[model samples]
Target: MGCTFRPHFGYCRRISTKVNVLITVSDDIYDVYGTLDELELFTNAVERWDINAMDGLPNYMKICFLALHNSVNEMAFDILKEQELHIIRYFKKRWADLCRAYLLEAKWYYSGGDVPKSIQCYMNETGASEEDAREFIRCLISATWKKMIGEQSMTSPFSKTFIEIEFNLGRMAQCIYQYGDGHGVRNHETKDHLLSLFVQLIPP
Candidate 1:
């Protein structure tokens, strides 16, 4: 797995970090800050994947969109130079899809209607307590992991490295959110986890 990333690991890591940061910022904007109309404009701009679309966005949004556009296009440019393959359309579509999903979430939130999430739906249908609903979610996660592991053992169209990366990403998300909204909330556990992962070195 480590060998698969040789020579370009630092570059890949940097791009991944930038992309994740952008995603977090975009999520925050759609979830807590941006107005419905503003979100619509932002989503449209992402879908269009045009720098000119930045003109109508607010100052903060303009900054965010430009960063996203530049970072993504830079990645696409790197790939094109290395592989002679144009992938900007795929990257743009992914960003557009993510923004559209966020826009839908914002719409649901601003609508002020009861949008039952999986846990809520389970609780509502089963008359389960919150704790039970949480346990149910845990079970579901465990089951999903089992399925993922099973699938990994079978022949897959994805390369082994790609599958490994995908699995690691899932694990990373689980670890991050295990303590509770680790990405959004500042807590001691998350701090400790980050320190262990990135700061502390193990004895050889």
Candidate 2:
């Protein structure tokens, strides 16, 4: 991936890779480690951008929050210094939003109802049948993809390399989640997929 995108800008490769890793780690923090109370505290801390907000959090949560906070800020600083672009606010907001979404899922899991595995909102809010909820989600995913693809051709304040990196991030996510939570859980197919892409050699 780095070699393929190097001509566009080698720096983008490093930043994009870091961002992807951060995304996965953040997902685990929300999915695996967080309890309702802890996740709420952490989410609020991120939204507030306050180290003081770390008070009362578990040690593990503090560590996760600090890592996310510092790494994102550092990356934002690098972007500002190098490109004169300040995107820290956007990054912070995105993190907060993601945490809220995860919190919703966690709440649903704790709820005593037999909630559908995905699209809980669609299932719970509108009293939609499972089939209808699935269809709605499919359309929503298609719309999101359309929006992202449309951005590829738009006139943006960001650099072309940055735009390409964003596109690649979306593509990577699609690949990882296409067959389920492939990144979070190991399975034979996921292992084979990774090996085929990263381990097996292909002759020119």
Candidate 3:
């Protein structure tokens, strides 16, 4: 997805795209498809990092988990072979954190309590007042962008191409969350951008 510029880090860009796809799929499963119990099981399986742990998952969840696991492992393999870096720990930690965050949202959604839709589920989970939640969203987005910008200015082990990909991702994430998941809803502007970005032919 970050290959729009025809950069030399095509492999890393592809890996980044795969990681994004996995996260999107898993988010959909947890938010739209899975029951609370099934999500718990799947999250546990990921946390445990055991193939056997996947045995109890539903067929759909098992499929999603396998795709995520295999893709992550393939990326790790690439990093290891090319960079002499064993970054699997970083990948695993990120995935586990993703699962935990998603699980919290799912729990809040299914708690069967009368929670106002105006307040985000995470706010409900955190016992934040609606006003506080609203303020927090602003602060969170600002803080996240600040951090990414700061990271971009710093020296890091990651390649410049990889950092650019991360910055693009953060920007996209901010856009997606700023207006109620426009990408998922395929809002007019989002649909137009998606079509242009993903479907239009490039001039040779």
* Root-mean-square deviation per candidate: 2.8, 4.0, 4.5
lDDT for residue 95 in candidate 2, whole number 0-100: 83
**CA lDDT of each prediction against the hidden true structure:** 0.87, 0.78, 0.80
- Candidate 1 lands at a TM-score of 0.86
Tens digits of lDDT, candidate 3, 87-191: 988988889999988898889889864424546765768989878988887887789788878878888999886687667767676556565668577567666
Error of 1 at 46 (Å): 1.1
TM-scores across all candidates?
0.86, 0.72, 0.73
Residue 130 in candidate 1 has what lDDT?
Answer: 91
Minimum summed lDDT over a 10-residue window in model 3 is located at: 113-122
Task: Candidate 2: list runs displaced more than 4 Å.
Answer: 1-4, 113-163
Instruction: Name the lDDT of candidate 3.
Output: 0.80
Q: For candidate 1, lDDT tens digit of each residue in 1-204? A: 112345656776677779888998999889888999999999999999988987888999999999999999999999999999999999999999999988888888888955467788999999999999999999999999999999988999998877877887888888888878787888899889989977999779
Clashing pairs in 1: none
Give stretches of model 3 more than 4 Å off: 1-4, 113-159, 174-179, 196-204
The predicted structure with the larger lDDT, 1 or 2, is 1
Could you tell me how far off, in angstroms, the CA of residue 139 lies in candidate 2 after the best superposition? 8.9
